[model samples]
Target: MYLKDVPRTDPNIDPATLLQLARDVLETEAEAIRQLAPRLGEPFVQACRLLLACRGRVVVLGMGKSGHVGGKIAATLASTGTPAFFVHPGEAGHGDLGMITPQDVVLALSNSGETSEILLILPMIRRLGVSLIAVTGDPASTLARESDVNLDASVEREACPLGLAPTASTTATLALGDALAVALLHTRGFSRDDFSRSHPGGKLGRRLLLHVADVMVKGERMPTVGHAASLAEALLEITRKGLGMTAVVDADGRAVGVFTDGDLRRVLEKVDNVRTVGIAEVMTQGGVRIGPDLLAAEAAQLMERRRINALLVEDSDGRLVGALNMHTLLDAGVI
Candidate 1:
């Protein structure tokens, strides 16, 4: 314990005093991240290269609090297109060391660079010939010296008033792990489609991967009515298709406009004979449409901007291909 000026613990600390202390701790940690920004250079790039070249997964290892951080880092890497998984150094000695293959990369995290459990497994990893990327606060520590690439996650000080707890150091290490993952993601050309494949069960995945073709109501079920058809016929098509709207197509099977329930209401207000009115008179000409390749998220944004619930899907030549609405997007988890 150091920093004698600050008390170890105050049982009766006031709410205002506690708030200020929390702010101070946050500011200290923020400064630690800023300091780590400049330290990213060759060693950091080397770690990315090693990971990118790794044919097998990246095996993350750490002890105590660092182990918790390592697990999160592993998850982030795996989700971002970098193959990785975490293994407890303590458990590795018992049996988990088999997870480290010759083609894999080992990222060991230890603030002090002298964790007993991590050091014990060093010889086994070395014998396997797996590349080692060491993350530590001490540049001269044994872990750093022996690593294939050393990332200096050193922080000036800990946010802990006693200066013994791992606070700023762990933050720096976590940030470094993120940097490596993002770098590898960029080098591997990890597109949104690629990221979505790794996360198919969540809203983020659906928004990125779900396309108009994937959810659009295609084939015979698509609501379509001839441009010369009566308004009543269009209404019947809408009802039968259950899409709340119908595409008005010309003789060439090309959509010229769209007629929705809102259009029906307006027609009824002005025209007494709904059955006799032509579909073209009440349809929205050159209406907003989307392609089958457009992402469902993009389609949702367009619908929100245009203030409409449904859109007509058309091919390159203006042929009606499919139909989709807000409900379709919701069903696909894109909304």
Candidate 2:
């Protein structure tokens, strides 16, 4: 891929130099975040307190690259139990500032702590009596000085060779935002279940929320045979259902045992007359089973631990309610 515009000065730089520069950029950003850790103090606590006590949403305001970072911070906060949304500082000064209310808290981001767009709305935010939290490199700048709590996101230098881009500064600001979100998540006692609710379309949501019953074969689709049935009948049931196994149930419709292809191999080694042998005589009694309400992920773990490919789902009375094979979990994206 060739570019339309070339500098003509040495566009074909050595690959080794490019790789080293990339490594250096990563190191610089990492060091900036490391330096931000010890700076946590009372201001961080005050910010969390203000957010926790807020009755309305947290309105995040920023400009340029800081706006991008603020949007992500707001999303993380919202997904982790805090109500938040980002408002572009440029848009807010026009008409978006009306979104802010007395009950809402304002979180503003500015690498220079003097972004004109953000500073333009300070008087209106003050009129609303909304608490302001600032994330900035300059603690003494107007935005920081006016904020109720100012978080220092200063870095030693930019990762860019020209030291003109918002590289290390943006990384430090993002890390600080993540720190605040995580602290609030812990303080609010957020759980995996809560996270799953907000992310129901993702793989983690499926693993956490999908249950065995939701994916298991039930009713007429389940393979089962009577305990008094011959080995041939059990094998026929297993073949007809294609689950490689068949549940051996008592006359009362409760599972008494299970017979699988593994059992068939053992039975064939000794008993030549498969039609005359009762399934109960060779079946594994009370095979590993799970309840209908068990999470699919837990069932997957149980199958892996027991070294089995299938499981029976039973109800409170131990009656076979459903059956599931490893393929079921795979299809459901549980494993």
Candidate 3:
């Protein structure tokens, strides 16, 4: 039942008491995770090795609250270059055990080390010659002893006032699972590009995978003016493109400089007439150019660092190909 539906211990619960209890729960869970740090040695290393050497997907199995944590662990592993999926232990005892093959490695989770559904399928798992890794609170428990290697996820005590809930134990187990996933990630040499590929629909993917060309205004959409063009002509190009800047190209069509709204403001103050001034005299020489193949996020960082709003995109030959500004990267979600 929801907390609102459950009967209260007292008609009026003190706000101070509720806040203190919440703090205590957090403290207990934090301590439990800290205790796991000292226990990380050979068993943790063996687990990582098994995961790294596995020819097939890592199958995660657990029951109750451990099963919930196992699902998250499986997702974390899969996203971080490890091939993994969670299979319910209850379903595995039915027909889902077929999902586990001899080539696969099984990572099981159990606080008591004796989850019935998981233990029931242990013999079949062993028959398939699958390497089993257990995360358990009890090292001497049946599931822990039966496994090839056990990682201790034991916590001192539950955060519950009654001493029977799965608060601190679950937190410790989740933390251990995270530690395992991160360790495997580092061991696999998983890169940001690898992670972005796995999470293509997310914001990180957009920031990492998107290149300058993918988000730049190109061809007819790009604003450009010849080096010999008047300052007024460059202003027209900038207004037409609405990018606040225009690349000044030479006879060979290579970008030699850039004229921006900022330049116009400076020219308006110093030059007698904007129409009489040549674009080259007023332009910022080779203003903040970027390669079309560079990452858009890197482009954004460069813009922020240089304190400029626009960037001209050039080819390897220094030919003007496109142009973009802070707004372009923002539109592409690179910022």
Compose the digit string of candidate 2's lDDT tens values, residues 1-335: 11112244876877776676677889989999999989999999999999999999999998999999999999999999999999998998889999999999999999999999988899999999999999999999999999999999999999876677899999999999999999999999999889888888868889989999999999998999998998888888999998889998998999988887887887899997989988889999989899999899999999999998889999888779999989989989987
Task: Give the per-residue Cα lDDT of candidate 2 at 116.
Answer: 98
- Give the TM-score (vs. native) of candidate 3: 0.94
Q: In model 1, which runs have C-alpha deviations exceeding 4 angstroms?
A: 1-15
TM-score per candidate, in order? 0.89, 0.94, 0.94
Candidate 3: segments with Cα more than 4 A from true spot: 1-15
Worst 10 residues of 1 by lDDT: 1-10
Q: Write the per-residue lDDT of candidate 1 for residues 140-196, one digit (tens) a residue.
A: 999999899899999999998779889999998899889888988899999888888
Residue 219 local lDDT, model 3 = 94
